[model samples]
Target: MMDPHDDVELSDLEDDAFIPSTSRAKSLKGKSPNRFLRWLPPRMRAFLENMSRIRLVIITVIVFILLLVFISYWNGRLKDVSIPKQSLALSKELARNLSNTAIPEYVLTYAPLVFLDSEDEFYPSDMAAHVSNAHPTMNFNPVKDAPEGLTLDNLNDLNDLGGDSIYLTSTTLLTNLPNYLHGQKPDKKTLQTENAVSCVIALANKEDGILDAFYIYFYTFNDGPRALGHQVGNHLGDWEHNMIRFKNGEPQAIWYSQHEYGAAFTYDAVNKIGKRPIGFSAKGSHANYAVSGAHDLHELDDEIPAHIVFDQTSQGPLWDPTLSAYYYTYSSTNNKFEPANDKTPVNYLYFEGQWGDQEYLDGVEGQEEFHGFHKWTSGPQGPIFKHLDRKDVCLPRDGGCIIKESL
Candidate 1:
């Protein structure tokens, strides 16, 4: 006979064998910002405070601000890069027969001069080593009757005219123009043409005999080790420098350092090659002469330091009193030009000499001397270097060179 108890046991075993393995779903546990601290011992809370959300928020804000600043800097630089082509095109389009009257008379008159501070007593021993150095070929004896009322301090009066883009509108002649042709960035390279920007020249509305006007020009170019002049002339102790502006309106000449040049750098070859001996400034040195000898000043040629460019920004070109003393301005108009107007000279020279390269006194040999320049090596000269290397008047800006108020 079959035992009922044995059957029951057999049934229990069968049931156990039939049961299928199933996995139960587990609910997820997300951490709450506050819930996390509850489980920690009170002692750990102090250390945990260091990692609080508030600290994280602070760090995030700081990082965000830094990012914004960096973005602004690059944005301005990139915008500047596009400026040259547009600026040059604008000037070229407006300028008819560029060689003639279109160049403005003041540019020919009172040609800006760039001179070495013959007064500079200090120079690197190595830089002092090689070839004899060059200096300005002109004199910079400030204008005597310069409106008697005009001063570099009144620049802000024009800020209301055009938010920093009105300075280039004047048609009157300028005796001196800045030599910001070669700047650190692509924008600077075209500075003389369009890349260079001039804001409105503001004046306090002259009433009596005194004039209260200011001019500002900003040369937005790159500065420091890796720039063109610095890279090529590093062995020569050259550096990348530039000119910033605060040009003014008021239609007239500002100042003049006598209308003459010297012979310190006016070598024989300079005169023999061309009648109008135009000179160009070194990218970094802003030296008055065109030749970029040897000796890199910043060792910028080998490599641009990784830390050279950090988060920085430019608020357009204007006179920051904090950065103004080192700057200067130039202005011009067409009526000032005389027929034999070597008086109003333009500092720019085309590589091939087509753009007024041959402009001179009709038949005068002195005119043939073309102001003592060689077309192949033409460099613009200006007045900013009047006190070159002077601890006082020189540009406080980092650019080793600042174009003198040239043509």
Candidate 2:
């Protein structure tokens, strides 16, 4: 989760929080008939002389008090739904369940489809985590203990295919987690920020009480800090024993990312393939996943991203485009690369200076020439971007992919 409120972390940001001139309770305390007249400006005080009768003034003060209570009551409930508290038993139970059940479609729906360098489709959260760092601890460095059953994956053979095992993201559970646990809600601030301006300060009379009871108020926009969200959520990926279960209900391979595998004290972002995913477009950005993991997703020569940071961290994705083998090329003839020459990140057929010339790619499905001018002669994505930003986009919630009977 990237920080959605305002890009960048609190430490890096300049303080711009809305601070009231005076506390609401203090300002509204014990108003007397003469008090109003004395405190108000001269012209206003003169006009209020008649209305300052004891009973009228007392009623006005009471009405103001009631409004505050109402605001606090309603706002408190919203906070409960967003950030819920995690139970040790529940976290362990969930980790074990993940090791057995075939993650449901509802769960799959929660994965985040990130914008690749190629501007293509997406991957699940767990898978994204694997690609990002190949470890869950990269996500949970703060936690000191591990839950049961999550210790290892016994379902599949995870000997790297001469490379590394791919961990999948699990926004699916995030999307559907609250359903399994009742009485849990989002953190308090999460809800207040959404409606704070419209709400009155009097509602804060019980602000301390609301904070204590409310669980979901920690507001969540699409982009928020993974650390904050993961902390309260008991992100299972970081546990030492976190295991991968197969579709048929058996623990597969033990899963962890490069960070967890390396065992370092400080987190290394450069080696980390995971981060708050940046999409090519969203509602405020663009409404689409550009293409699948490819080389041309970003503007050419963009060494570092220059967009807003949710927590103001210098960021990168689970994958890097600079290491890929493709370039965003265009010719007067729009030559679309299909079945994406996945062998390498890009293909030379489109760049050999022969694509636009009707020699070979003249009648390609994606290449239509208008007066022999090139429009978009690169990879075109499928009808729908497979992943959304919020879910499986960053980690592999589905766990490892495989099956085996229990010994």
Candidate 3:
């Protein structure tokens, strides 16, 4: 019967005083902390709400680990598809540009036709593709201020940055056996086509119209032979070669690289497919030889027992390296490589570094040493260290160049 506004205010105050402060606080705490949980099922929401902080963190970490594993698996698959295309493109470009150069006709005519073993998995690799897939490193650590995207054209830049200590470390783990590591398989139909694998030909003009032609072959992975039930001497990169000594445009002698040492023979002594010499690449090691059979490594060093360490070779698929190759003239005087085509990359030739990963320690994962022998060893240095400018047919370290009369 009094003022209506006064009556309403008195009723609101009475209602608030009826509820205790503790009871109101308890009601607020009972509500879901996260509004998103409202969309979840009742049982699931309750379980998550009751989970301890430590349990929640452990579950989160497991989920994150699973996600990372899924991403890595797919990433390797993507590389398998992309690497081949990249290699093919580089092969085609090198072949196309080769036409512009004035490479001697005899160089191609006498080039060694390599025979890869029938059971061999690894094949000839492309240098440009190799450089593209690797990064410069020093002592297993990334080189500081190194080139962002290293390529064959600028490979020599690393010589200044890290010099002999630099390593062109592969991006993919060597243990993974990536497709690129298998390299370019020779196709009979594609041997003469743009799809052919590329090789390196470095010519050294000697005194009195003498020409020493070096045919270098690259492989992404070197499969070491099993010794005493353990794989020993395995490495990430391989460089095998053959050097032909010619006088007055005629072949005189040929040399085949095998491990640290190689064999040399008169040009007429080796088997020939027409004017081209035939070389057999060892089953897995890719050591070039003039004939097929078991090649005794002890022949180079008398200290090792004969047949204890040997390479097996056979006549398998023929690989014509001349079909696709990079030609260059090496000047021993200045120790420089001059590419036939201006577009050909020569910087890589000057690189004085290892082409693969350094040797792993015994305690490192997947690496071991048995009876003073390591399962894995350091990769071979680039062709530059192969005595490219040597005056004799054999490497300078060989003391005297032994020219074998037969295989």
Candidate 4:
């Protein structure tokens, strides 16, 4: 009975002796101080503590991968847009107002017979019809003040209302290659019809009794070439031309518009049907070439290799433009356009705006680019800006026309 208190004191001292030292407890706390980790086994807690040292690096790598994925997604969705620069300035000689003139007999006599590619989806289109299907736009936005009922007859009015950035955007979005956009395919019956208007001729009188007759053809759409299974350089409203220079009513040289450049040939060198020369319109591009074959669109001269893009042409549909076309005489000296007949639509010739939709911007729906190449390019300038009053057989910027004797 006397030793009960002493037993209790001894038990208390023994418990105190078994307790961990303060330094050891501090070491354990440093390893895994988190309350959540304390509930885990010693081995697991140690493992988790060790992993914490490199956690920032692991998080950094994950973030970098996500950034890469983000960049790739936008790259595939967007495209680079190219807006064609304004056309070169007109010649110094200038004048005003419209007039009437006679269509020279030589113009019809030496007019070109165009050969459309059999595989081409688009064909020669009527200017008035195109106007009826489109509305005027500025910088890809609708021009609120533009005329509601725009047509070839009133197209020139746009020049008075800030025409610099104006564009005739299609009323319907160009998708799936619509039938109306394919345009009218000329036939013997349609060609014979007096009201039919599919092509146009602009005559310019040069020095020494030389006459330049430009046969301009229009197409509603221009399909681009496919590269690596992707389409590039597509656009709306194509305008191609073949110019025949005459010396005293005799055909002397012929120029075929191919892409940005053209070639001139002696009158006798080109293939002809009766008194008219034959021009093969390249597939989809509608570029006029003197011969029917694979034309390298990228090659500027014989010295260069044309291993990239090509325009294919063949003897397909034969179209005699002379049978149904509008005729006009462009006077460079006075910068005036004189229509051959009152029925000809001369107002459109004075229009300074683009004839088709402008280039679509990147990230726009249904438009994209691959490897720096755009799926769609800017619409080409109208014939009035194609150096219609050019003095040389080729455009002045072409560095003088190289008249080839053969293709």
lDDT of each: 0.26, 0.23, 0.77, 0.75
Off by over 4 Å in 4: 1-101, 188-196, 300-306
The TM-scores of all predictions, comma-separated, are 0.22, 0.16, 0.73, 0.72
Candidate 4: tens digits of C-alpha lDDT, residues 252-313 = 89999977778889999987766778888888888888877767755754533356667878
Runs in model 3 lying further than 4 Å from the true structure: 1-102, 190-197, 302-305
Which candidate has the top score in lDDT? 3
Clashing pairs in 3: none
Instruction: Report how far off residue 190 is in candidate 1 (Å).
Output: 12
Task: For residue 80, give model 4's deviation from the true position in Å.
Answer: 46
By summed lDDT, the worst window of 10 consecutive residues in model 4 runs over 87-96
lDDT of 3 by residue, 137-215 (tens): 8888999988889888788888888888988888887767677877887765444324434578899888988999999
Candidate 1, residues 130-239, lDDT tens digits: the string is: 11121111111122222223222222232333222212111111112122222222123233312212221222222233232222222221121233222211111122
Task: Give the local distance difference test score of model 2.
Answer: 0.23
> In terms of TM-score, which candidate is stronger, 1 or 4?
4
Better of 1 and 2 by lDDT: 1
In model 4, the Cα lDDT at residue 382 comes to 80
